[model samples]
Target: MLTQIQASFAVNALTVSMAGITTDLDTPATSVGTAITAGTFAMAAFILLGAKVGSRFGTRGVFQIAVAIHGLAMLGVALSVSPAMLFIAQASSGAVIALIAPALTVFIATNYHGAQQARAIGFLAAAIPAAGVLALILAGWFATTIGWRWSFVLMVALAGVNLVLSFLVKKVPAQPGLSIDWTGAIIAAVAVILLSFGFSGLATWGIWLATPQAPFDVLGISPAPLLVILGLVVGQVFFSWLRRRGREGKPRIFDLRVLATGSERAVTACMATMLFVGTAANFLIPLYIQVVQGRSSIETSFSIIPYTLSIFLASTFVAYLYGRFTPRLLATTGFIVVAAALTLLAFTVRGEWSQGFVVAGLILLGLGQGSIVALVFNTLLSAAPKQLAGDVGAWRGLVHNLSGSVGIAVASAFAVGMLSSMLLAGAQEHPEISDELIAQVNFNEANFLTNEQLAAVLESRASGPELDAAIAVNAEARLRALQISLLGLGAISLLAIVPATRMPGRREGDLPEKLEPDDDDVIDPVDEKETVA
Candidate 1:
């Protein structure tokens, strides 16, 4: 269980760090948008497929296969030349996750029970965030020194290690004669692909009903909004198909019956919200350090050390709090703390603010997000039926992965949109500014400017004293653009509060009530039953 947990964390860390590096390499907002979409699409497809495969082959088999696939995919990403190749590699890696995640959950259920299972899952959950910190630090250093390719190479090596560890596990006997839902799989895949592409396009292109012409002509026509609509329609059809198949005694992609449980819904919601908050913070902070503060990649990664440490510390102790404190209280408090940190960050992002503010904010955010995530996963697994553990685990993974991807996507879109709007507003206010000047001013490097500096630059551009004023104005504008983007991200953090409220209050020692036998069952002499019943 520990090995699997560590492997899962390592895999996620590699993927996320690679994503951040890819954004840096492909500097434009459009590139970031596209990469996020491609990566997300690939992840969704892989997880769904992997779940089906696990059902047929058993957890260990699926896990080993995933490890191999992940290694190859990492290598492919490292060697990729074109954007298309990168997308393909990302999708393949995502597929690997699908295989491994369900298996990991099944393994936990099979090997451990009760509080031990909860603790193991908590530890496993913590591994991801912990690994993320490590990945970011490593990626920043490697990207700065050896280049992003080396990071991928490192990922391949980690995947190899995971493969070896996976082989050490004893295999569970496979469930015989399980059938795969091919049609449902195809529909789900298509829906995810279309939806990811559509959302990516929205982030790159304008989100208005009618597309604006200023951006590079995409497919010679705007396809974002259209694709989103198509995806929704396709998703509806997929769900209908699943329903029909269930009625026909054929296998279905999603077992909707499992979702009927309140605990299941709450757990899924909590995980989604946790991912949303955590990923949004992760997405923005690096940009804040590297671009706005003009920190080197290594420096930026180092800056996150406080956050990483806080997460590690917080995660380690959450298991102790379970049973003593309800998940609702812990999660709610976490969300509030995170929100407070974000709000503080928004206020402190001026020229006069110290680096300490940023570090403090990062630490708080990490502590809150890390605790909530660990707690939520532990609770969800405990709440689920033993027989349905694999399915529930897959569902949890699906929601978390999807939420993280969408959170980043939405955050990127919102930040970019706000930055663009602010830039345009500044430009309009200074009508004399040239397009070249505006282009220079529109650079979206994070951490490059303070709000006051940006305002001053806009003022100078409006006054038009000299060429130097123009340069200053451009620089300031670029800085302000980055600042506003951070603010947008901070605002998004508040959304987590709503879902956090829905979490149950159960703590670690509080055992859930076991299900009673159905009334039709004949009592065995060895079993004790209440005489009144």
Candidate 2:
């Protein structure tokens, strides 16, 4: 549980520190965004290798080394003087998390069974939101008082504690004869990295069409979607290679046996959806508070507290309910709650921050998010045999990190596109304004700006009516873009219910199995229950 908490905290600590880093390094927001994107990319791209490495080497030995590496990365981050250094530090932390994730999951699977295992998984799930809350409070304070670098200092301390605690964990026997398929690993890494970069570029580059910021274009179309498409094609190739290895009795990066059933795939889908929505919301809310409202990081953190707290409390409570209710029932209910909350939030957004309605909506989202995360994760863990836990962890890491990147990218692109459209339409409304003035403001990109900055930009050239028109148009367009994005997020949540329904109707407690890798048959829920009887 501490291991999981450390991992999540490292991921989230940057949230409240973005402003400080940008200011101190004299860099644009994109640099900080790149740091985050690189970290997530590294984690998702290498997680399968991390799983296999844990199996090939000893889990405990690899875990300790990973934690040590992570601690060193945090120290590097604390001493970073430029955005380049920060990016490298963050990427290093990400690579280490790839190792820690599988080790922690395998530890839980090996050491616990049945209800105890379910509880442990629930605690792991709870740690994510709990860590978010802690990061916001502590990281926000550190960023505000000392510097953003000190937040990394905090992570270093936590990593040291986790390294010491790693020794206490049960040691699992390593598989001696497993050989890594370097070809498959390279293919998988390339596929995930391409997909992550594609999504990350969608906001700066165009989503469907080419933008001025695009590095290069294919004929005339944007390379973002092209990369995503190509990445998917390559991903299929990797899976085919895995299937061949499975048939030939050769070692593969991922354990193909864990994904043999529809239930397992469905659980993956649910986790991906939950993470996508959560990541999108987390990114957009801070952006609104800081960029639009001109609030401090602490203020942004305070604004999000209700959401984080709700997730932590709900996750802990819902774990107790897993033995009594089916995952399908719990997941279905959670999605409905999230969808409704997002709808309410979409309607409630305005130029003036509606604190009451926003808090209400966030709390509701927290409830559903907490429940789905804990319940679905437990379901996925319990579905697999104990020895395959590392594979399950790798799957979790891949889905989560990939979805997070996609969610942020899609939200950014959607909001930017809508804002551009709105700004162009508003500019058309005021034909009195000069084309040169429009170009100067770069209204096509439509970044949020304070009223004073807007006035300053127009003071030398234009006066009363044109300036007022520009300000009104920019404010309205920005708010509208945010609202539309929230609604789109709601639509994504509603769609997730389709996968949520595919979860097994049986409770997780009845589905525990102790099969080996050589077992050819799938663990049918009914058969497993009968065998336990």
Candidate 3:
């Protein structure tokens, strides 16, 4: 559970410290965004390898070593004075989390069984939001007060504690003879890294045409879209490799049986969709509060706490509803709720800070997103045998990291892109703002700046009514950008209903007081020879 918290904290705390990083390092927000994506990309790329390595070597030993390394990484983060150091330390922490995440899940399989396992998974889901809540409050405070570095100093101490406490977990049996599939590992890592990096870079490097910020261009086209295409192709190759290995009775980096059935595949899709929506929405809220409104860190915490608390509550208590509702039904309703919440937010969001309607929309989002998160994992884990626990965890981690990276990337790109278009359009149409003044301002490099930031930019170049109009346009543009992004994400959530319907449904009277142990749950995955669909 602490491992899950650490994973989530890596994202949330960095977000809270963005302002400090920009100020202290004399770097732009885009640079900070890149650092955050580097961590996420590392996690996505290395998670499957973590699972295989843990199975080849004992999970207990790997977990401890990873935790210790994570502590050192956090220590490095605390001392980082440049963007490169911050990036390296954060990426290292994310890479080690790839090891810890699967190890934690495998430990649950080793230590718990049946209903207890379901509850444990529920708690694991809950921990994600719990970390968000903690990050918002603590990271915000630390960033506001002493320094952002102190927050990492605190993480280093917690890592040390986690390392010591890891001794309590039961030893997971290791398979020394099971050779690590290096080919599959390389293919999978490349695919995930390309996808994660490509998605994240779309904001900076143009979505289609090459932007000024792109490192290189392919015949006037951006590398971002090309990378996404290549990632998809390589992903298909990884599946083909898996099929070959499964046919030859060779060990795979990931077990196909974990997602062998159509229902299981649907479960994975639903999980990713739920996480993407939640992560994107969660990211956008703080971004608007911090960047657009120029709010304080504690203010960000106060504004976001209710939403995070709602998610935490729903995730922890949602297991009680499992007996009454089917996973399919729960997932369908959850998507609906998420969509409705986003619609509410879109219609009600304004240029100002949090309003009553905005708070209501956030709470609705939290409840829906939280329920689906716990339900999907419980459904997926319950279907897989105990031996495949590590694979399930690795896949879950991959989705969690990839979806999070993509979600934030899409949100940033869409919001900033809309802001850029609207700002120029508003300037072109407005009677007060002159085209000459607009020419002086480079809309191409537009950021989610506050009125003060816009004012500072326009103050020296031009003054009076034209400057006011430009600032007003910026204010309206940034807010409308957020609204449009929310609307689009809401539409995607509604479309996710197609996948939700494909998830496994329970029979009319299949209600059990607890998710009790079944024969399939205890079966050894190696003995089962189900073909991958």
Per lDDT, the best of the predicted structures is: 3
Sort every candidate by lDDT, greatest first.
3, 2, 1
TM-score of each: 0.77, 0.90, 0.89
Tens-place lDDT per residue, model 1, 10-94, is 4444444554545655544445345445555666765666666787777788778777887888788777776677667776766
TM-score of 1: 0.77
Model 2 spans > 4 angstroms off: 22-29, 81-84, 352-354, 427-444, 457-461, 514-533
Cα deviation of 2, candidate 3, in Å? 2.2
Where model 3 places Cα greater than 4 Å from the true spot, the runs are: 18-35, 80-85, 144-146, 351-354, 435-445, 460-462, 507-533
Number of backbone clashes in candidate 3: 0
Q: What is candidate 3's lDDT per residue for 1-533, written digit by digit as tens? A: 88677667867888888889889988898787777777777878889999989888899999889989988988887888888998899889888888988887788777776667767877998998899888888888888799888888888888877887888888787889878889999999999988987887888898898988899999999999999999999999998998888777788898877776677788999999888888799778887788777886678778888889889888888877777878888999999999999999899876466589988998999899888898888788777766777888899989987888788878888888898899999999999998788887788778898888778877887788888888888888888998899999899999999999988785222122223333334223442553221
Better of 1 and 2 by lDDT: 2
Model 2 clashing residue pairs (backbone):
none
| Per-residue C-alpha lDDT of model 2 across residues 1-533, encoded as one tens digit per residue | 77777778866787668888788889998888788777878898999999989898888989899998988988987888888998999898888889988888898887877778777887888888888888888887888788778877877888889888877779888877779888999999999999988888887788777888999998878899999999999999998998777666567788666776777778889999999998898777777777667776677678778889999888888878876789998898899999899888888865455568877988999899888988887888877766678988898888888898898998887788788898888877787666777777665566656667767877887777787888787777777788888888888888989999988787645234653222335544433442343
Best by TM-score: 2
| Cα misplacement distance, residue 452 of candidate 1 (Å) | 16
